[model samples]
Target: MIRVLVVDDDPLVCAHLEAVFGFADDIEVVGEAYDGAAALESVLRHRPDVVLLDLRMPGIDGLAAIPRIRAVDPPPAIVALTTFDSDHHIVRALHAGASGFLLKTTPPRELIALVRVAADGHTVLSPTVSRRLIETAADRHVTRGETLARLAALTPRETDIVACLGGGMSNARIAARIHLSEGTVKNHISQILAKLHCTNRTQAGLLAQRAGLRPPRPAG
Candidate 1:
């Protein structure tokens, strides 16, 4: 089972999330915290597999708590659960070690799926949030040609995979999209990571964004 800790200052939100988890047999709501300070204490106690965190809190808000939570020996995957999207805070949270950035408005089923994604060691983003990141990257002063030039080491297929990753497609999805087997997609991703000197898919996604690449569709 995927153990999850719900951390939100709003008790209603916490209870709502717990209720959502009840629908998914593979997920268990292990604990809840009202604020970031209490979140830290709960993490130490439960060591959950994932954390659904709220960015704005009374004390030691989600942003401040990110690095501290990540410092734990077996750090839990954190998914920012906030009402805010299309904000720089989303980018900050991602850089600060959050595995996902999700709007509290997310549908319950999708939110539960995102938790499963996090537990599987993949980054998650609300569809709107993903679009915002692509738009934000596109608005940067750097030209697309200039950005793409940095990825000279990648082959054409690797480049395609990177774009898919930027769009937040999972291996299975990418395989179906490109008419390749899942194993092939995974192998390509491994190669892409090695060539880009990235440690994980999230880093590859960031690099793809830096290279002026965006997925054809928003993250699902």
Candidate 2:
């Protein structure tokens, strides 16, 4: 079963998540927290597979708490919960080590699927949010030659994988696009993360974006 911890300041939201995941046979709602402080305590106590995090809260917001949570041994995949998808908070959350982002109004079915995807080391960017991120990235004209130069350390195949990752493709899709086995794609992703010093593919993408690179389009 995929263990999950739900964190949000709203009691109604917490209860809603608990109730939603309660019926999932493959998922277990292990614990709940009202704020960042409570989240830290609940997470250490439960060690869940994934954490549903709210971007804004009373004390420590989600972005600030990300590094702290990552410092925890066996850090869970953090999927941020937010109301607005177009804000800089989404980018900050991803940069801070969040694996995925879901608008508060996302359908429960879609949210559950994304949670599963994140737990499996894959990302599920909301289509609308993703399009916006792409446009936002493309509209910026800042220079990042120095950062892109770091790609020199990667092998040719790994470079391809990184570009695709920045474009937001699943490992399975990348494998298909690159004509390699999914296992091979997974290994390449691991190598890219290590070499890039990124916590996850989402961060790696942001790094590439800041480095002045546009991720390749999703393979047809």
lDDT, candidate 1, at 132: 59
Q: Give the per-residue lDDT of model 2 (tens digit) for 1-220.
A: 9999999999899899988887678999999898888888989999999999998998898878887898898889888898888657776787788888888888888777878888898766665575667435422444467667777788888877887777777888888888889989888888998998888888776665565555455458
Candidate 1's TM-score: 0.74
User: If scored against the real structure, what TM-score would every candidate get?
Assistant: 0.74, 0.88
**What lDDT score goes with residue 160 in model 2?**
79
Worst 10 residues of 1 by lDDT: 133-142
Evaluated with lDDT, which candidate comes out highest? 1
TM-score winner? 2
Candidate lDDT scores, in order, read 0.82, 0.80
Count clashes in each candidate, considering only residues at least 3 apart in sequence or on different chains: 0, 0
